[model samples]
Target: MSQSVLPQSIKELQHLLWTAADSDYPVYVYREGPQDGVIIDLSKLNEIIEIDPANLVATVEPGVKLGALAKKLAEQGLRFIPADTLFYQDKTVGELFYEGCSTISSLKYGCTKHFLMGSEVVLPSGEILKTGGKTVKNVTGYDFTRFFNAPYTDFGITAKYLLKLLPVPETRKSVSVSFKGIAELLAFIKDLKASHIVPAYLLWVDLGEQSVFRTDSSGQLVMMEFDGLSEEVSEQWKNTEIFIKKYKGAIYEVSDGCSEMASKWSCLYRTTDKYVLTEEIKMPFTAQGEFYKIFYEKAKASRVKASLFGQLAEGKLNIVFAENYPQDTFIENIIEAVEQAGGVSSGKYGRLTGKRPAGILAELEHRAKIALDPKMILNR
Candidate 1:
């Protein structure tokens, strides 16, 4: 933990940055609390600066919660589709980009970085660094507005963000399906993909070994979400029902009216957070069958009780296990295996680094950081 400072206004924020630049200790931009080093709490920077409904864009402070901002945008019949799976009620826009939160809809909508139009950053040198522009397509220069995708800290404090928005979909629906076996489930997913129905999300869930579904069920739960025009959604729903029935699998549809999608997504997201250690494995969807085979075998051999969930569309597997399980060694082995199999894994709570950067690339990153934070006093 580090000392905390709350800046109520931009001037105060600038002064705090000046003090941090002069100090010997590193400073971290803090939202909820001090993540590391000294804390620069930006919670007071909560504000919805501007909303252009015509352009489907909004300028918001870093501290504004996604849920609150969504509601504000919804008032104008627009939505900020976040890159977070569960739509966490308390999660802020800053934390999403700063922490690089992964989302279920990433396969279709792309990641959080795509939604970021611009930002205002308070560099560690006590100077403001504004990047990007207010428009959607600004390819002016280096995308300094983009997140670094590290868990520790950014080069500076994120003050404000310009977010791209979308009109609230006219319809939204989710379908949950259970298969008789893993092979059967994979086959169904393969068929669904070939059918060309683009669901908002397709997630695979492990119901746990103790659950009733464990004994009587297929040991796999696949959830699919679809949102768009009413007619298209209805047609897809019907086709999906027929397709599932073709495999003799159980299917249930939960429309957006019940808010069931959010509830279920939240439940799965919470399971990952409840555990002490978790690692996300990313691979091609085609290799999921072989990858999961190796994954389960390793877990069984290690006697580790692991919960599994995946963003099926993007082929990202999220594995969560209790603290009692072998953490370091197991994760290292898993990462090695995943890489050997042409997959990628970022150990326990960080963005996946597909591969290690080369010497010059790594050096460039370091030089860029130093150029912005010469003292390394802002969240080293």
Candidate 2:
């Protein structure tokens, strides 16, 4: 494996990139490594540059941790919404946007790209480039801000960012419900949709035979989170309770609170380091039930222990398999099923930043890479 470079300042980073551009070595940027060749470690750059409460925007260094920033914002009665579906406390703001992470709140707040107002990046040629502006209504030439979101460091390293913020909700409540079967879970969700109940996020998860928590019942769990004024959250909770009861599902307040909910959701969503075979499937909302139906049957037939979970409103599915599972054919079956359902698969979960399939999207990325990193010294 190649060594790494830890730059403390933007000038140092640019110099490193410039030298790399002059060389034949490939460059890669990551917070942690196994990143081969020239690895750029950005840990020292963690800083919250500015927080403008009046404008509801914050400018932060790429290395700023998501949890830390959220806490800082919380002190001001604000929140930094991330697009990541799971709450990874250690994830940096740069990593979140670079990887195009999604959060359960995506149903209401949109993805990581949506909150990104602008960014400062060091091009592979060691030149500094800024895209977009602090204002939300910026109408730039090409809107390269969106293009750079989750570019996999193939174009450049995001050095700084301007992120939008939201006022913190007065109250937050989470409900965890258990269902005996997929049919029951589906019924509950159908009712939930029909009732026009919009929670911050609604997640349905089924960690098969090898699940770690609450496994005694061997049933699926659905978790819903509501945030707003106290009265509003209370009303939503009341409606949710009645709707869940009609399907005979048991509901309970998430005892520990939002932090606990985030931890549990992250645990369920992320594959253990031991299990490297993980996949993500995203489909249209209309096709979720059918996809799940087919997925469960195939998973059963294959006897692969699959931990399945998704954002109900957003129509995204995540599955993590055991380390030694037969992955090739299994993934093929999954892709085929997803395609049949008029859905798309991101292939690997968090790692694959490019959501579009490899043809046109690949071509576009190639062109963008050339435009931004002409030296081809960046991640390839």
Candidate 3:
């Protein structure tokens, strides 16, 4: 059995780390599963330390939930760039940052790494290290803040973060359309990319005979959102509608609820079932169509149900599988298909399957781990 400790302050956390370091048992931050070793829960540390509106920066404790922080910031007519993605609003700032979560708006603002300006990380040996600053251009030495970008809890635990913020747009609107097939959708996406109208988010979802966004059509859906001045948003939407008509896409009559339902489109299939597997693949735009073709063929051949949703411009695709499907064989085949399509798996499946690259980079990472976590007590 493992013991869980919720440290309410930095002093108490440091003491816990120091005590854990002296023992032979492993110590790690508590995520969502059963684990061996002492677990530290940092949720009590949640707090919005400072919001510098003039500098467009927000200093916050690691445990602060993103959705709550966004609402607080909105009161001042400011917002965090990454919070544009509604699905991740419930996640804590530290949790999402550690997972390197990206938003549908990545087409416009970028990922969690881009929003992280600075952080205060606590190492396993009870040492507190500060990296970066409140300014956007704070790089005096090695970029230590990015070292924790991935879910690399083995490195250290982040205590506080200095995140970048943006001014709330005067207007925001979304438009939804459906395509007969992936080919037409890809063509339309290419055309939209070349156009001057850039959207906050342009998502492609394939629900396969199930309509979730109130669309009567069963084909693939493309939902786009534009945010800016009222006139700018309206003009961009008008041009987008014209593109949909040119592509022969059926434009669905969707409400202007940009924040509510638009965020759920990608995550609608997620469930608490132990057997359900969701994998995220990163690949070139040119390879995405082929990847999906291969994925669907494999899924159909195995008689397994699978659906996909992703950010079109970012070349990121998430595939969700029905519960109780054969996990090993299907995932192995899917990974092989992803490699064949010139894509890399960016989810847990990749790490579990040993798909991560090995070389000098791997050696450097191992050396860093040994140097910083000599006892291997952090996330052991």
Per-residue error (Å), model 1, residue 107: 2.7
328-357, model 3: which lDDT tens digit per residue?
A: 678779877888778877656654343554
What lDDT tens digits, residue by residue, belong to model 2 across residues 1-380? 77877799989988898888888567777533344577788888998999999888899998888878888888898877772234556778777766555666887677667788888888888888888877856736788887776635368888989998899877878778888777778777777778877888777777445452444445777777888888988887888888778888866456424645455556653435645425767788778767777876887787766656777667787766655354567777888999999988765543443344467877788787788777677765
TM-score of each: 0.87, 0.90, 0.90
Top lDDT hit: 3
Instruction: Candidate 1: list runs displaced more than 4 Å.
Output: 30-36, 83-86, 147-153, 208-218, 270-273, 324-326, 347-360
lDDT of each: 0.69, 0.73, 0.75
Clashing residue pairs found in predicted model 3: none
lDDT per residue for candidate 1 within 1-380, as digits (tens), equals: 66777789877887888886786666666422344566767778899999988776789887888778877888888877782335455678777776556766775677767787887777766678778776746636666677443333457777878888888788888777877666777787777788987787787776545221223444567787888899999998888887788877776556663246346556444434345326777888778778777877787787666656777667788776654334556677777888887888644343232233446845676677787777777655
Considering lDDT, where higher is better, how would the candidates rank from best to worst? 3, 2, 1
Worst 10 residues of 2 by lDDT: 348-357
Off by over 4 Å in 3: 30-35, 209-217, 254-260, 263-271, 274-277, 324-326, 352-359
Clash count, predicted structure 1: 2
